[model samples]
Structures are given as C-alpha cells and as structure tokens.
Target: MRRRPPSREELDDYIRTRLALIGIDLSVLPEDDPDAPADQLRVLRSARRVLEQTVPALSDYSLDPQEVPPSMYPAHLPAVRQVAMEEGRPAPAAGGSGRPEEDAP
Candidate 1:
C-alpha cells in the first residue's frame, strides 16, 4: 500500500498553523467576499507579484516549491548563513583588488 498525499485543506491548515506560530493571523481576509476592500485586494495582488518574481529565481537555484521549509527562505539556508559566519568578513570581489581604490593610500 502507498501513502496518500495530503489534501489541499490539510496543506492550508499546516501553512496557517505555521503562520500563526509566528504571529500571523489571516482570518481578517474576507473569504470569497465580492465586496472585499481595495486595500485588501492590492495587498493580495502585491504579495502574488512578489511570489511570482521570487519563485523562479529560487527554483532556478535548485529549490522545489513543495520543499519550502516553514522557517526557511532563499538566503536563509543553513549553508549560506554558515558561510557568512565563517568568512567573518565580506568576500573579495572578482578581479578587483580586495581594497577600495583611492582609499588604499
């Protein structure tokens, strides 16, 4: 016997629980209401726009949509954060001397 994937409602509940853990409560959004406020509509649109722009870049860099961890973001990956800490200072730029020009004197 094979395991079944969670239903959409289950996934939504999981996401909402995670959000609530971090002080977000989406209950204020009017569910399927035709008379929802313009400000609310704009917020939803802008959020979608940001996700549209973000998802492709994240996927291009080897992230999967369903693999999104509740507490994670693109730059917040463990390896990336670790590398920053280990560097202790910023990395040198490519083909550029490791110091600012004119101020090196």
Candidate 2:
C-alpha cells in the first residue's frame, strides 16, 4: 500500500514547530494590520528561499496550493498566494549607473 500524504493539520504543526526552533514567533504576528498581507508574503518567500538555499534536499517542497489543503492552513492564504503569483517578474533596471550626470559637474 502507498503511504498516505500528511494531513494539513500535521503539516501546519510541523511548520510551526520548525519555525519556533529557528526563533520565528508566529503567535505574535499582527494578523489584522493593514500591511499584514504584504508582510506575510515577504515572510513566506524569505522562509522558502532560506530553506532552499540551506537545505537542498527541501528545494522540492513548493508551496503550491495543491500541495497544501486550504482548510487547515494558515489564515493568510491570500497573501501567500499573492507571493506565489509574483515570484519571477523582473524588477525595473537601475537608472544612469551610480555616477552623477555630466551636467552636474
């Protein structure tokens, strides 16, 4: 028989425990702050990056919704989803290098 996939509650507990081990306090997060969505996106992206960079074995653990059940996951799903959506868009190029324009001399 095939091994059953972990339930969302199990996954959430695992994630929370792991975050605690590394000093991240999910309980203190301000879920109602106006900028909470953006902040959550940043945190999730940063965590994903750190895990991928430091533990190559976990690089395969993408946060795609299909992998995570919607019911038992964190309440900030919309924010995390937004982060996933913006993953690879290019940033605007820097202007005129770092030097002052010739007219400024």
Candidate 3:
C-alpha cells in the first residue's frame, strides 16, 4: 500500500512540535546538565524556518524520485514537484537523457 507524503508546512509544524516535546522530556532529567548544548532547540527551530522560507533548497533529496524504482515513481512524483515549487524552484526537468550529469563526463 502507498502512503501520501505530508505537505512541507505540515512537516515543519511536526518538527517544531516534536522538538519542543524533546526539550520538555530533557527538562525532566534528574539534573540540569550544564554541559547540555546551548540553544539547541532554538537552532533547530530556526533551521526549519529557513528551510521553508529560503529560496535555496535541497536538491538530490534522499527521497527524490530520481533515486527510486520505477514502481514507486507513480506514487512520489507529485509531492516532489510540489516541494520543489514551494521552495521557489521549478519541478525537475522531465525526460532527461537517462544519465546522471557526473556520469556523462
């Protein structure tokens, strides 16, 4: 069975909420470990915002359809294109010559 990918905004919300939950869990620790990295959650939260709002985006994403089997292509392409568009880039070019750029060199 196939599962639909969550939209980018939904993912951002989930990450922020999850990070806050982790911070809460850490707060319950037996001692305030002074060595704990400072503003770790804040940095993560900022990074997530940067991801959604920044024009520069990740290419060669791990879940990229280009990396997947043909069978999964029918399931994943729309979300990939949507994410690319949301990040201010066009959807990946279609019908390439079937070789990775580096391999062509």
C-alpha local distance difference test of each model: 0.48, 0.50, 0.51
What is candidate 3's lDDT per residue for 1-105, written digit by digit as tens? Answer: 233545766765666688687774433433333466545455445666665545223332324345555574465665776787788765654433332333211
> Considering only N, C-alpha and C atoms within 3 Å, which residue pairs clash in candidate 3?
none
Q: Which stretches of candidate 1 lie over 4 Å from their true place?
A: 1-3, 37-105
Quick one: ranking by lDDT, best first? 3, 2, 1
| Candidate number with greatest TM-score | 1
lDDT of 2 at 40: 41
RMSD to true structure for each model, in Å: 15.6, 21.9, 12.4
Instruction: Give the clashing pairs for model 2.
Output: none
Candidate 2: tens digits of C-alpha lDDT, residues 1-105: 233555545655666789889998876665445566545435554565555355543433334443455467654644554565588433222222232222321
Better of 1 and 3 by TM-score: 1
Of candidates 2 and 1, the better by TM-score: 1
Estimate the TM-score for candidate 2: 0.31
Q: Candidate 2 or 3, higher TM-score?
A: 2
Query: Least lDDT summed over 10 consecutive residues: which range in candidate 2?
Result: 96-105
How well does candidate 3 match the true structure in TM-score terms?
Answer: 0.24
Per-residue C-alpha lDDT of model 1 across residues 1-97, encoded as one tens digit per residue? 2325455456456656776899986778865555676343444555555445564345334332225554555534445445755877442221212
